[model samples]
Target: MDKNNNAVELRNVEMHFNMNKEKLYSLKEYFIKFMKRELRFERFIALQDISFDIKKGDVFGILGLNGSGKSTTLKLISGILSPTKGQIKTYGTIAPLIELGAGFDMDLTARENIYLNGSVLGYSKRYMDERFDDIVEFSEMQDFLDTPMKNYSSGMVARVGFAIATMTTPDILIVDEILSVGDFHFQQKCEERINKMIDGGTTVIIVSHSIDQIERLCKNCVWLENGKIKMIGDAKEVCDAYKKS
Candidate 1:
């Protein structure tokens, strides 16, 4: 891929939200409080002055601690939340694995949910049919195909979700801490699958808490602290610095 070919770009992007300072019992109570000038809110800035460019086929990592806006940044890139200011531009189709069960119906069997979830992902019936077996094999849920997902374990659900979400080689794959899915052995399987996607030239943006995982899988990275960029550079250097902090 061309070095100048950008897969994702953000310029001075910022996110803001007004958090309620008090909770009311109902809409009627909220209206009475608002009328009486009792409503209070605090401005929360989730991201500020964020700017970065992810080149085509680049594996980028975002590292941060709890409440550091790491997941918020991924949500912005995945279009789950719009930026409050600045610009964001992305090239090619995006596959976001931010929430594994977003499209799942808990009452539905894994078999039914596979096709339903595929449709939610914008795949046609024929497309899903062709890849159905591959999905089952990847998830290793052959025995539970007919079982309701409501009865499945968290790891089991995550595996199926991950398998379906990554079935195709997307142009841009936005993964948010999904590597923690399943057991240690299954985590390795997930990493191997992601590695395969990287080999296929997918532009992956990963947000992970594991410093070693970030260094191993990413070429470049950014560290965010208090919703601001603390460092941005080679993955190893960034990870090393973040680990020290």
Candidate 2:
């Protein structure tokens, strides 16, 4: 942990998208010489006036309904997507498990894809080398290690992806609803590993629609509604409010 307690900060961040609306004209209408503007555009706001700070060793939970900009907020923090407005500053090395199969090659074997994905996540060949056996064991992928990833089941793919993404320790860990992919046993393993990371002073940000997970795992919480901050406070309180609403 650094001298500053806050590991991540979002200052009035906002993101918006331009949606185009097209007008339909029938052949009869066109023949009658009745025409209008072909295209109209509307600005859709995905995140509005979102501000929060996450401290090192904090298990921060982001809870919201679908399309509430939970994933967008995680992406903005991880540098996967830039915010359209406001500012964000984060310290320390961040490991993000945002999307499964985001970087894996379908044609490559599981073993080969692991190395490729590791490199994409900023791990060197030697680093992967040191952790290779442990990753395979944790993923329970030993049987299909040499098989092409496309041949594996969806669960298998997620296991391998999760194992590779989390093999190396990080100063900050960001998870965007990835625990829903794996089976119950694997989810338990992931939770145990995440708890270990938290114990070791790694800042964790969990974005999930599962209010139970948020309440169980997070010490602090934030709720987002229609791209705006709804609540920020104790995990139990925010979850109770979300459930009631």
Candidate 3:
């Protein structure tokens, strides 16, 4: 596709993490080891030279098993974490549902977080105020709106997060694995909303382990393995190949 038609573009992206190669029993042991020049570190590459294009208004899918860097890719696009190397370009506003409580403050009440999170997403006060009721209604947390976010269950936090992210159509909507944490009813409602956004011409990127869901919603898919892209093409074709692997 042409560059003008792309909603997201990633080029040679790589993410790296430094980890202690060996574990010490305690700080004292670690100090002793360090003093003896015995400490070792490993440079782990979570994503290796990833590159892809998400077409405008398309439902793009990322498929991989655990530790394949699916969530890391989303974070780079969302601007939550910068890429250690390479470049990422996004055309418009992005709403990201990457993980549970990712952008929320634990001590803040649900009511306050609605605004807080909205602000983080670049929504103005007036904008969030207009959609406040809709957010609470969709999440079904009206009763606990005053409760601190730390007290909310994982499912409840996921509900609120999804509601705020999808309250209105964003140019780029990125969803990770948070939908699977919701109950069946919540999941159904969320899918319905996603379908609505699709009709409204929103560009969506989804990372899911569910092949069926990917086949149903995505037009193009990328499969990653061992921090590298194993395949990229039609959703069904990649999913079929993934099942065999």
What's the number of clashes in each of the models? 0, 0, 0
lDDT of 1 by residue, 129-194 (tens): 999999999999999999999999999999999999999999999888888878998888989989
11-52 in candidate 2: lDDT tens per residue?
999999877553345676444444454445688999999989
Candidate 1 regions exceeding 4 Å error are 1-4
Residues 115-199, candidate 3: write the lDDT tens digits: 9999987899999999999999999999999999999998999999999989988998998876698899999999999989988
Please give the distance, in angstroms, between residue 85's alpha carbon in candidate 2 and its true position after superposition.
Answer: 1.1
- Residue 237, candidate 1: alpha-carbon lDDT: 94
Evaluate residue 175 in candidate 3 and report its C-alpha lDDT on the 0 to 100 scale.
88
Candidate achieving higher lDDT, 2 or 3: 3
Best by lDDT: 1
lDDT of 2: 0.89
What's the best-to-worst order under TM-score? 1, 2, 3
Q: Which has the greatest TM-score?
A: 1
